[model samples]
Target: MTSAPPHQSILDKPFVLDLFAGPGGLDVAGHRLGIPSLGLEWDRSACLTRYAAGLDTLHADVSAIRRESFESLPPEINVLAGGPPCQTYSVAGTGTGREALEEVKKFIERLMAGDSDEEIDKELRKLSDPRTALVLEPLRYAIQATRSPNRGHRPYDVIVLEQVPAVEALWVRYAEVLQKVGLPDGTRYEVVVDVLATETYGVPQTRSRAVLIARREGLGTPSLPEPTHRAYEAKEWNRRNGDSAAPVAQPTLCDASVPGPSPAADDDLEHWTSMGDALAEPVGTQHRGRRTPFLVRSNYGSSGIPGRRGVRTDRQPATTVTGRISRFVVFEHLDDDIVYEGARFSMNEAGMLQSFPPDYPWSGTAKAQQVGNAVPPLFGAHLLSAALGLPAPAPEVMREPWIPATEEQRAKLRSHGCGTADDCTARCPRPEDQTPPRSTSRPRRNTASRQ
Candidate 1:
């Protein structure tokens, strides 16, 4: 395993303090980058996974933790990175996006006005929101850490945060506040926030997150890193940003594991990896010289939410793999000897799609929850690289490009007995298992697919 560059002591290296550190995503990436780090998390299942992964962690709620309680620093640099709990600010939450933004503003205004916890709590309770205020905890620590040592402070030299896209408003507001907290020498924080896609940084699946990066006044600067792989075609106006991501297509699910012609022989190959690549196994149907990719969570349930076709092929990058991925169905191709074809993704396969090591040594009863909640470690490395203004090397999990199986090899497999489509419906939680087609009258729940 690669370690951090030559630093005299752990103290000489800027340590990363990860808050709300679900499953050590940032911490694991920090280690890969040779950076020393520790995580602060409250979930027992996630904490167990962290210990299993050999990551340093403190199992406690951020709301109750104190930066002053940490060990004394050696007067070098340090980093504060985390994704505060954001369910209340997510589209999945009961609170409206506008309401969440207002709540954040109120929290800051109250903090600036020196309000008591009880007073703040009373107003938050009136808003019927409790978790919305947690975003402030990191700010509290950032301010505390960057204070002058004469004030007994352990001010962090950098701050990195992430949340759902809806919380971008909250993060922008935060930069406005964090810039004010300074050391005794009047060195203020430098901050930047951007919405970044995981795929743009080379993760197989596509997931967009709002990222915030900051540094001490003297640090060079805070800027989001340039994309490594290509992003899906940008909108008509987004083209002006000039990110200049690779002209090559974004990696597909197959890049992680697939049997195909060597790409070196042809320069115009698709870069996107496929689920089959990550799973490192064949689920395709056999017919003549062709083998069709396997389908997971494809439309084959008794019922489900509409517009969620869940019909991606093993040859394509899997859609955002979520925490509930365990419950999704796999529509096995109707090959010879398999009349009622179907299967579910093993926890390992799902985790791999999320860019985790194959044998992560997961230690949690809620395995799916742990996998879904944490950031993909590869993507986490990208985030850290952006904050540190360095390159995030591609993960070593990728195998060499392959040559497609010859016809003789393909003939050994079962034949595809049925046509291409799987007519069955998926099972949804609602009483009626049937998902009705979208009506022209009722508008879409969202304008764009949250790709």
Candidate 2:
């Protein structure tokens, strides 16, 4: 692990308070950068996974943590980081947050107007999904840290936040508000907000997230991280033949006919990582002998096309992993027949695809959801490095594998006397009998033959 250089800021040490910290993704990234982090999360399943990974955590709702309590927190805490709950803002979900965007802005205005917490909480309760209000909780903490006399009115040196791409507008609003916040010392936040594609940061999946980074004036202006990998171009596979109604078949790793996205004209960045590149050497003992050149078929339809399933070859980066990841099927071509490869991605494999350590201890139920929702630790490290004005972690450092939890860490969980079935020591259990669903559409030739 690499330690951050001594900062020139007022704080002697840097500690992090991560809100809505799901499964310690950003915390793990901070740890790699030699920064200690404490996370607040509400889900028991996520908390179990966090404990198993040996992350410091308070398994409580963000809303319940009063602003006054911020004063009592560790004084060295100078960094605020979080990825608030995004279900309502996700395009795949109900869109409650998207619909309530204007209303949420009004709440921000109220907060700016110095409305009492009780007044804001009362109004937030009436939203369709109360979770939508959680998005503003970071701003609340930021306000408390910078303006509340109870906290000595010391502004956090850095604030980093992330959410689904749909929340970019809200993050922009945050940037605007944060830049105007003046502290007692004549310092204000310098803010940057943008949508980041995870694959461009070397994560082996194509996931887009809205990110906001703020740093107090004089520390440095925060900026988005530069890409370390070529962006995945879906257009490479969308080339059409004249008069052909159907699109061309996806290319495989061995298919030399189709070239990848052209590299940037000015900078050198590695080609996008393929699923095979990440999973070529299986992580755990159970999957050590599995063969490669497999294909993954999504259980859900693509582009809202009925019966049109999405498929990706091992040579390509995976589509975004989601809570319903268990519904994806992994299979290989055996002569003319399709053979299932372990039914689907194991929990560890899914984590690996998301750039987690191979032996990262994921515990408890909804394990797939936990992995899906996590910030890819690799991406997190780059983002944090950018926000903190530190050197980017070397590619080899990011790729170095290790067991996330030590035997002592496991013992610590046992000492807590947690009797739940999803015990911390045990590997995250797979979904019950996750057999691949039979395809309803007419079977086409296997992806291997498409080349």
Candidate 3:
């Protein structure tokens, strides 16, 4: 896969149609790249948030929408993107999607065999969980674009899909089917699929997702985005500490004397973005004068141990942000003593950690779930740039504050009782007047037995 020439714009006047779009993550990225995007989502809350953010949206189910529905749109939809609902495939949920994998593969095979949509839908109705069938919606859309006469016999120039890591096998099957799809001019799609670590793309969290990118061979090749930052590695002391060992605390941001772990050998890549780096700044009046050296305790256990909970210092990348993020607790720490109990991360902070603009307007119900489920806009930008063979966006683009594009959008936000576009007030706890007791002794090094 050779890179497109610098002078040529592969995505000139491109338009993206995103399925299962949640709160406009990829849409935000598209906006940053000067590309137009429209999202098709059924969730009312998500749709409300999308409208408030000034993104074009089709409030409908992915399965119900067909190619003909988009023919009336002003822009030609050449880019197909989606991140399907992954509840059934998630390890934290029921393993129904994993069990139904074989059936899903069989469905894909039938689709490849030119089976009618009615026949496929009839079989899909028999599944115990209907959501499992939604994963194949992207493939169905691709088939419609390529085979439908109403679309001028033109296939989507690009297709990108993301899901939980367990869905990598399904993406592989998608790659196979996409490669077999031949265009009128004897061209097919070039495909690539892999599990990408969020931190590797500069997201201040340790989350992984299976991603697939396919481009028409006639246009150019498709490739996964290269990592722009090093993967986060827990300090050796933290990693080796067992449940029986004393909890290990990271050095505070104020303590410059204690050095951090060495940088990666690759000088080209930047160090992984840490939770401290993301939250160090005050967002409006909230999170002001926060106590240094805080620890985040996970609500879930590690390695099936009942009492063993995972913990991380602000200096490290955060654990996977999930729908249950409200349950995670943050506490101010001074070596071994808990100095002050702090509030959990606010919706704004959670969105920031997921690489959304700190002040991006978020509305409707289950706001935490919306932020947790979104693809980090920065990560999406890089992925889209790579998939389109365009130059990666500048680093500063992620930090820029989002502004309403028109007076209508501003009016909508005001009607919804939202604050100024720059308002990023989080619900983080403020530091109290009482001072924490100072430690008389030096902090002990980790010398506990690994066994």
In the range 1-451, model 1's lDDT, one tens digit per residue, is 2222322222346678888898767876787778878777767567656665667665555655543443333344378888876666765545543476875686775654445656765665544444566777776665555454643565677788998888888778777766774433345677889888876666667677998987766665667766765553323112432221222122122221233233344345345455655565442221111134454543222134453444444544566776778876554435433423345666656666777755565666788877777787778887777777666545673221212323333222111101112211121112121122233644568746776
Tens digits of per-residue lDDT for model 2 on 328-394? 7776655444444545788878888888877777888899999989988889988888888677767
What CA RMSD would candidate 2 show?
A: 8.4
* Residue 226 lDDT (model 2): 86
What is the TM-score of candidate 1?
0.69
Clashes of 3: 0
Off by over 4 Å in 2: 1-12, 147-151, 181-187, 240-267, 284-291, 299-301, 336-342, 404-451
RMSD of each: 14.3, 8.4, 11.4
Where's the lowest-lDDT run of ten residues in candidate 1? 414-423
lDDT of each: 0.59, 0.73, 0.73
lDDT of 1: 0.59
TM-score of decoy 2: 0.82
TM-scores of all candidate predictions against the true structure: 0.69, 0.82, 0.83
